[model samples]
Target: MDLAFTPEQQEFRAEVRSWMEAHVPKAPLKTLEGREGFDEHVAWERELASGNWGMVTWPEAYGGRGLDLIRWLIFEEEYWRAGAPLRANQNGIFLLGPTIMEYGTDEQKAKFLTPMAKGELIWAQAWSEPNAGSDMAAIRSRAVRDGDDYVISGQKTWSSRAAFADWCFGLFRTDPDSKRHKGLSFILLPLDAPGVTIRPIRQLHGETGFAEIFFDEVRVPVANRIAGEGEGWSVAMATAGFERGLMLRSPARFQAVAQRLVALYRQHADTASPDTRAAVLQAWMDAEAYALNTYHVASQVIAGAHIGAEASLNKIFWSELDRSAHRAAMSLLGATAELRTLPGGKGGGEENAWLEGYIFSLSGPIYAGSNEIQRNIIAERLLGLPR
Candidate 1:
């Protein structure tokens, strides 16, 4: 409960800050399709990998700095403050890497972990389908065992990073007759397999960062299964817990964005009403609260305590705050904001980063278990409420 960082922790923060100031790109990361900006983001990730700061808390064997979780938080703060590229393979490295560390075989670790840590092998999450999204237990994608391989056939929509990823980790119904949560299995498949097809989905913001994937008898090696058949629901749930919680709701990233939003507001205060000033002040307070919550969670994680539903609360707060802050920014920019995409770019700012962020924020309330479901978890499991 002591909130202060130790002397060693403070020193670690200074070290990370110094490293990032030297390496972070001079300009903001470019959205994909931008000439040098996209490449620059990739280069920034590689630069972090080169510094052994890619996955701060992973074991050294997996290409990490071998630091503890507190130090990892410091690294994240510094990375965001320096305006480093967003972790493009976060679905692979943040959510799946930890799952594999706990559940995967040594061979699986040797194959996926190092490459993921080094940013050499980017991955996508192929979980949502035309029918099964928030209700992951309803997944109908099937993978039937065929000697040394499994033939997978189904469609996955909202498959982020599939347009550029080399692999995907997802759930499949290996026991179709077993019903609901009992029939599923977790599996990894190469995206370039002959029978696999990927088509990009253009967002409201004009970005094609997400896609739909079709598996037409796509064959994957039996070695790709993460957990045993019938254990996929638990594996997927566990993964979602991380996705919607501490790892995905990194306070440092949110705080940096919130800071930028504040700066953007100040740059155009003439357009903001007194009510808008109140909204911005509230947002700043919420951002600070989120930072404090994350720091507490980091301390608990570093002390080897298991994170629980409280992480869900953190996700809920930060995601909504992100939306609120961005909306405020767009509102302040007024008519000029309509000039989106850096003046020469097409569409409004709403269609660029803020719009994309707002759309993505909408998904936050739905994914990793909907906010209503998260409330159920908090009420029943955390608060001991009646079913």
Candidate 2:
């Protein structure tokens, strides 16, 4: 299997590299490793949009470069290489943008896609409720149609970024009597609507990226519905597919982490034992494997392949790998890793990064569909196991 790019692809890589070097911020915006509170992160996203780097895979008409998936991969590689800020609107650009392009109406596309690509609109997701997490079909949020609007009433917990978001996209039960996965509708809602409440959940890293959102008779126009009533499961599944696949966890992200791990290893080499050295080497190798697989996925996507259950494998790999890499970093940091906050009068060193990374990595297996669920998918769908 040839893992090389063509001349055109190589040129695209250089172009993206040059653009990233030119436009990537000179200073770190925020250290959002595990913590949240990044208003500047949104500003950085718009900066990328200004540089035409916000959503390179999106169409040119929608303010993107209209690049192929491979080019998008190249862009991601360069972005990470520059140690640039991660896009604050990843949920919108990575998952919802593509789903809307495929299943949204022309009006929906005209309304959401362009601003999304331009980083003008920020979106949050309300998929996982208190009672329903990995089991999305268990969502009880009701959107009763009343004339021209749907009066939504439910509580959404563990909502990522809703506290600072402009809009929200989620699944709602349009039919009270319909069974699981049926009678659901995908709807877009404004966060500022009356009766919509957002309460932040502070993480171990002292950030409020996660939140609990309550909707009390919040009214959303029927025009904001993505797929028609009773078609939400399909729309949601499509979005989830993208979530597990290359769209969310790009291979370039793993590569960037690997480089960081290498630098961390060098920083504390005197303290590293032979066993720790071996572990670091293994992580480097695993990160490379993830990169190669990402390229394979990018090539398949460029060839117009509709990503499938195999994307679950990547999701499981990266999430677990991230967990392991951060764990190793903590181990390597030893006693110094306990301090999570920045040094005030009492000084903390590089270990704070490891502690924050470790805490952040703990969430990986739980979010984006649990690792257990992904394993089940691999067994039932990929391995032909009985449900």
Candidate 3:
């Protein structure tokens, strides 16, 4: 794949850099896991939308610049380099928005896309259930038809952003007799709907970035369904591809972390062990490799190529890379890594960003169709191994 950028692309990058340098918040916003932080992040999203940069890959009609995947990558790089606030509505803008654009009715698009871009509505994902974390087909959440409405009743766990999200997109078994991947329907529901309950789950870092949601005969309009009945599995798999391949974990994020890791090592290099230094270097190399691979994948996607099992490979690579980078950071910090609070407010009062990141990285292998499932896909599909 060609690595060179055209003059236009270079100019675009310059424009993005200038905009970010000028407008990114000087102080980092609080984490979006709490109510105060969530509102702060929502404001940031609106600010980004006002500049038409909330979702660059979206169509111009939807408050975007109608940019290509390559430009999106450039935007992400600049965004991270500027240390912008983490997106509060990432589930809406990244995973669900694309699926909606590809499957939603024109009316649905008009109703949802604009508000989502403006951060007027934050979205959470509700896919995993008590018994169906990785084995999604085992989902027991049921949505029974009732005239023009579907009554949903079941429970979903580990829902990211659910604690304060306005809406949710998830899979429900519409056909009670159906098993596995069959008889499923993709649907969107309001979080405040009657009979719905949300309970926050505190992470190891004492943050509630995830939650459990319970639905008890919650009623939603039939119009909220995506694609068609019994097609939820196929639609969700496509979203999963987007999650594992490009959007959910961007290469720019890792590259920025790698740069920080290197800087951290340099600060303590004189006293650092050889293995720690080696790990730091390896992290940087792996981050660069991921970025390059992403460029090739984006090129093919823009050329109308479909990503298959390679998404699994990409997921595995980046998740492990993230964990390894954070682990190296912890090692560099040594005993201080465990300190609830670092001197000079380095760890955000009770915990530092590195320690917080390390905690979050532990979940990387488990989410978005866990690393084990991705490896199985790689072996069975990509490598032609038996299941």
Candidate 4:
């Protein structure tokens, strides 16, 4: 396949780059994990939405540009290149929005999609329970039908963005007697609903990036359910593919990080060790590989092909590359890397950002299905090995 961009695609890239250059915040916005930071990120999301950049891949009726996958990738590249704020509503836009488009009713889409694109409803993923992390089939959360509503009761831990999110999408056991992945329902819940509690879990960097959510007879309308009962496993698997394969961890992010790594290496080349320099080069190469792979996959998607176990391979590749790149950055920073504060009062600069990224990178191997489970998927499904 030809890797070169067509003239039209190149023009599209230029448009994205120019827009981001003009609109990206002059100073980095606060981290989205803190209370104040979450609000700031939300405002930034609104800013992006105002420019119709919030969900370029969504249909125009849903407040998007109705762009194709290739343009979407270009937008992401410019987004990261601009060093824009982290997406405060990524759970809604990346994972849930596409799933809704696929499985939700027209009413559901009309109600959720527009607000989601406008950053009016930030979403969290409540997929993991205390007993269910990698093995999501072990989730014990129950959603019992009560007339026109379902009363949900259970706990979900490690829920990203739950601390300040307005909504959550998750799977629950709808059929009491069914086992494993069967009889499950994908459902959406308002975080402000009665009997719902969110407790923020501080991360290594002392930020509430994840939370534990408890539901005690939380009443949700049947209309909130995404697909039919017992079909959640399939819907959720598709969402997971988006999470692991493309949307959640885009290649543009790594390319930007890799570029920053190279700059950092150049700044310290005289003092840097040979191994660190080599690692920096490797990071750049890995980032380029990921970008190429993503473009190839995007081409296939455009051709109406399904992405399956290959999502697992994508996840493992990017997650490890992220960890390695951050490690090299930390190594290069040496003693200053550990400092959360610089001499000035500034909370986040290049040094602190890398430190924060390193902490967050530690979770890449765990969330969106653990690397262990992903490796198992590669071995059993992709390689056709025995389970």
Q: Give the TM-score of candidate 1.
A: 0.92
Best by lDDT: 4
For model 1, what is the error of residue 219's alpha carbon versus the real structure, in angstroms, after optimal superposition?
1.3
**Model 2 residue-pair collision total:** 0
What does candidate 4's lDDT look like per residue over 1-387, in tens digits? 787878998998898888889988888777788888899899989989988888999999998889889889888998999888889989999999999999999999999999999998999999999999888999899999999999999999999999999999999999999999999999999999999999999987888988999999999999999989889999999999999997888899999999999999988898899999999999999999999999999999999998999999999999999999999999999998888876666744333888888888988998889999999999999899998
Q: Candidate 1 on 27-116: residue-level lDDT in tens? A: 556664232444555666678899888798999999987888778778888888887777776887789998998889999999999999
Minimal lDDT window, size 10, model 4 = 342-351
Model 3, residue 85: distance off in Å is: 1.8
Residue 120's lDDT in candidate 1? 83
Off by more than 4 A, model 4: 346-351
Ranked by lDDT, top first: 4, 3, 2, 1
Model 4, position 67, has a per-residue lDDT of 88
Q: Of the candidates numbered 2 and 3, which has the greater TM-score value?
A: 3
Q: Rank the candidates by TM-score, best first.
A: 4, 3, 2, 1
| Per-prediction tally of clashes | 0, 0, 3, 0
TM-score of 4: 0.98
- Give each model a TM-score: 0.92, 0.94, 0.97, 0.98
Better of 2 and 4 by TM-score: 4
Can you write out model 2's per-residue Cα lDDT over 1-387, one digit (the tens) per residue? 676788998998888788878877776655532333256778788888888777988888887888888788888888899877767889999999998999899999999998898778888899988888888889999999999999999989887888788999999999999888999999999899999999988876777777899999999999999878999999998898899888898877877887898899999999998888887887788888998888888778777787788988988999888888887787788886787555562332223656766887888888888989999999999999999
Expressed as tens digits, the lDDT of each residue in 214-238 for candidate 3 is 9999999999999998899999998
